[model samples]
Target: MRNMLPAAITAIMSLSVLAACGTAGNESGKPADSGNSSTAPAASSAAGAGGNASIKGKVTFLTNRTDMVDKEYKEYAKRFKEKYPNAEIEFEAVRDYDKTLKVRISSGDFPDIVLVPTIPNADLPKYFAPLDDLGLNDKIYFKDYKATGGKTYGIASGASTVGIVYNKKAFQAAGITAIPKTLDELYAAMDKLKAKGIVPLASNFKDKWPLQSWVYDLPPAIAGTANVANDRIKSDAPYTLDGAYAKSFGILKNLHQKGYLEPDINSTNWEQSKKDVASGKFAMYLLGNWVINQVIENGAKSEDIGFFPMPYDNSGKINSPLNPDWFYAVNKNSKNAETAKAFVKWMIEDSGFDKFAGFIPVLKDKQPELAQLTEFKSFNPTFIEGVPDNDQAIATQNKAQIDPPAMVQDFVLGDGKAVFDKFNKQWADAKKSLGY
Candidate 1:
């Protein structure tokens, strides 16, 4: 079992612009102008006067981070009890959380606080209570991640930048003096590592999602936009031979064809990948900073590991794509909606939980001191926002059977051309169904 949950940004030059409250972005990174203004009653911030009186009941906080159950949450629970002595909070942590959260929502038994459900933001009114008036909108780092219909639906728990996590010792052994600034250098460095009898990159293709992550990793560098997916949606043939989408996949194919990825990628495991990368058995893994602690926890010295943005093409400066991790939202159906909001507010504004978890705080002035993110601090790379799927597009995608992750797996295992051709057809059909 992969003990570490794969945590899943915007382009802002200044941290203030990054923290500004605004309209939410659709699944394609386009502004959600659905024209549906939120008429739902605004839930007052629990920090306001007389708010504590309504916050005494038990509030169930749900998250996918089972690893934090004994480590972080226990400490948080203790601190929360000190503040709200009468109120009780319980955590519901589980594996395969995205699927399970949907199951719970479908059953109408969802918890009070939801952590990054796979559901669309437009549909948030159905499941999560609004948090627009909580005074947290301007304080958050990624406004678009949870904004919908001009209302903030969820509060970002923390922030992270996607980059190439690697072993410094392995780089040294491979005679790599400086970090690669281009894809050519990266591939060359991988070749050197392979020659030194080290696994160049831990593909973790067997895990499916890791392989599927190329969609996230390659685009910011290739398209030079956070709204890459949305751009693809607008272009009739975004996956054409000369397009950035095709270029991104071509890089993946090159990596595999050159044997820079693990020899038997289909059998590779993520849990073991952490240990191997940490131990210098493997050189690198393209992942988010959220997995840095997991790599350290799996038995390697923190100093041994480092992170750098993916150097796709010959771009002089690496464009690091920043993103918010799990977002905490209050469930609309919760009996203790106010209390749940209070708990979430405490966690976001007061608890200082993000700092302890090695996360970049969502607040504007806050900066992540995480060792892996140290390299990016001075780089001043552009922060790219991720495109989110809208309800209609999501419904169309479901009907079209366009599974990018599964398609990625098929590309590697079977025929690449055939797989992408099917994908292009499905995506077109889905778009047509939505009258796009």
Candidate 2:
């Protein structure tokens, strides 16, 4: 249940711009002296730009892989190092990452490559560099999506499938014989687990957004079904979050009222909750590939975990949505923009695509091992074909609305009867307002 939840805001975004901004060291020793301060990057002597005369400059990256204390993103960083042996690549793991990214953009000291954060549209434009002007157009895989998202802004570092992750051992122990195919079954299964004294759902509510993903992640699949007009789910359409979200909420609320979600779900620490399930105390969680990695690595036998495709719209039918894991971007201001582009090219095209780094690469060849946790293949979609090609329209119609605005989160976090009453009235009003 909680494993299906998205991690943190900063953790997920910066990995896409992994080569970009990182922790900034106040190494000038001139710190704590003035208000107008700046972080001077450690210099490198490596050659860059068409094999220039000893290119020695630092490319700061923003990441939290600092836990890999001894091992850096050694592979990709190593290649960049060889190309510019004299350059000292200073990898910075910024604390309070969301704020740090904003500070850099304001200080005129932005990272060479910065992540285009999904921050509800507040700070995206200034930090993101458009790939179109760089001639990266021809090389990108989604030529169908070429002109779509306005700016080629940046490419996702990798992609993942979003769904519910369950403990196979827990399910077996609880004597629950099948994965829940629809909302009702999911509730009934949770009830069965509760009777056994097992917490049916576990997640880090403190991290906040993990809970948020429940609200946001699922709308795209159900809403995408009508494939609505102008690529938009009509304001009057029955399946839009306005229509469907409350219904989803009602389902989740039914679970909560029955005590399926853990008491104090908000109190759980993210790492520990995930570990708890991997350790087999909690039975279910919602998550994507990242959680799968944790379950497998944490001593859980390979066959012991189940990743469920969430049941949406009461239909019990499977409709998986694409989860964009991460994307890459070039610094518009860099003097060696072409070489930077070349570096991005090397990542997705050659060894970069299939290499087992911390991420699941999106390129065509060698993808990280996409393991199936259950017999339900539809829970994990393999392609983006036959889907509405509009990017924001797709997000608006399907995903963004899923959690709170959509049905998923409301059922988990809000007043169920209230959400239903409110949205249902809103939908009815919209029909009249549309004058149809």
Candidate 3:
């Protein structure tokens, strides 16, 4: 699912001056190194104004948080302007951010700053300005997520770990005294909730994207492999019956078969699901930690909502994947290149957007203060930071038309084995045709 953020706070009284950053290379697959540090470029004046005080100009920032554009985003712009009184930041919030941004990118008419979409790493320089001069490489996590040839193109805005966002009131009402630490315990808790006439979990099947967590995000933690996507590139039949894909999907399937999911799956609504969970009509949602704030905003008391890693198995050991949320990047063609770069830097460092959005800070030295995150840490789950998808792995999945979420929908609605067999065949054929 797409991400969302909340309103901004007061502007920082003191802001650091940043040097103008430059893009090192073009679309040709040449190294983007800026002839300074291997991971970042030396400060240069070619891109924009060199300091926050000197920064001036207007830049439009493209964002996915359409819900916050009118009020919250305006507050962000207001705070930003306090630091750079001469600079103006206009937000262009799109409901369908990835699709719209892709079209804008194809037409070479995107905004100055954007939440980097799902384009390949090799294509970064083709559209984005090098962010090396932001001097964030050494200080941030996932600095290399969008980097190639030692030059960073994007900086992660924040990080999240997928887990069960549950209502504590529902758990207490159902007499679930202990947090479920294993798959069996989770199912038992679901039974207790169901017996109390509550929807045990929200399938969110109709939304499609939320179902993706079961296949894309949960499997890595289930399999205890951080680089599972790249690891799949080595196998034509990555969807074996005994594989992590099967195990992860099976958990959701079991929920469906046992009637632990919401009734009338075809009519499930994402927005309503949040409200239902918040109101304790639904016990849980298997989603990222980011959803905690959304649930609270929908009326769940902050203390009533808690998060824990998904227990995909009964082993009691939990491995959660710590994944970055959308990355922030500067457009290569922005007329206000320096201003755009400065805005991106300011958003990352000074905006306080990460904490407000309930995400783990991308800055390595910073820690999230969310109570849910503190509770999650108490579980002592091994965190597996995500590995970037290999270009070839992505290519193979595209060629094979393997939509993990859709596969999950098929599993719950139709036959699980048949769905896997069909995809496995397509994957093998695609691999053979690609000579891999």
Best by lDDT: 3
- In candidate 2 the C-alpha lDDT for residue 350 amounts to 40
Judged by lDDT relative to the true structure, which candidate is superior, 2 or 3? Answer: 3
TM-scores, all candidates, are 0.82, 0.65, 0.85
Give Cα-based local distance difference scores for all models: 0.68, 0.49, 0.75
Error of 2 at 322 (Å): 1.4
Pick by TM-score: 1 or 2, better one: 1
Q: Give the worst 10-residue stretch by lDDT in candidate 3.
A: 9-18
What is candidate 2's CA lDDT for residue 115? 48
Residues 122-214 of candidate 3: C-alpha lDDT, one tens digit per residue: 888999999887766777777777888789888888877888999999999999999999999999999999999999998799877788688
Residue 208 displacement in candidate 1 (angstroms) = 2.4
Per residue, candidate 2 scores C-alpha lDDT tens digits across 112-221 of 65544333222244455455543434433442222234656565455555567788878877888988887778877877777877888775544555554444445445
For model 1, where is the 10-residue window of minimal lDDT?
Answer: 1-10
Candidate 1 residue pairs in backbone clash: 9-385, 10-384, 10-385, 27-387, 27-388, 27-389
Model 3 alpha-carbon drift over 4 Å, by segment = 1-50, 95-100, 432-435
**Which residue segments of model 2 deviate by more than 4 Å?**
1-56, 64-79, 93-109, 119-126, 132-140, 143-151, 225-242, 334-360, 373-436
Relative to the unseen true structure, what is the Cα RMSD of model 3? 9.6
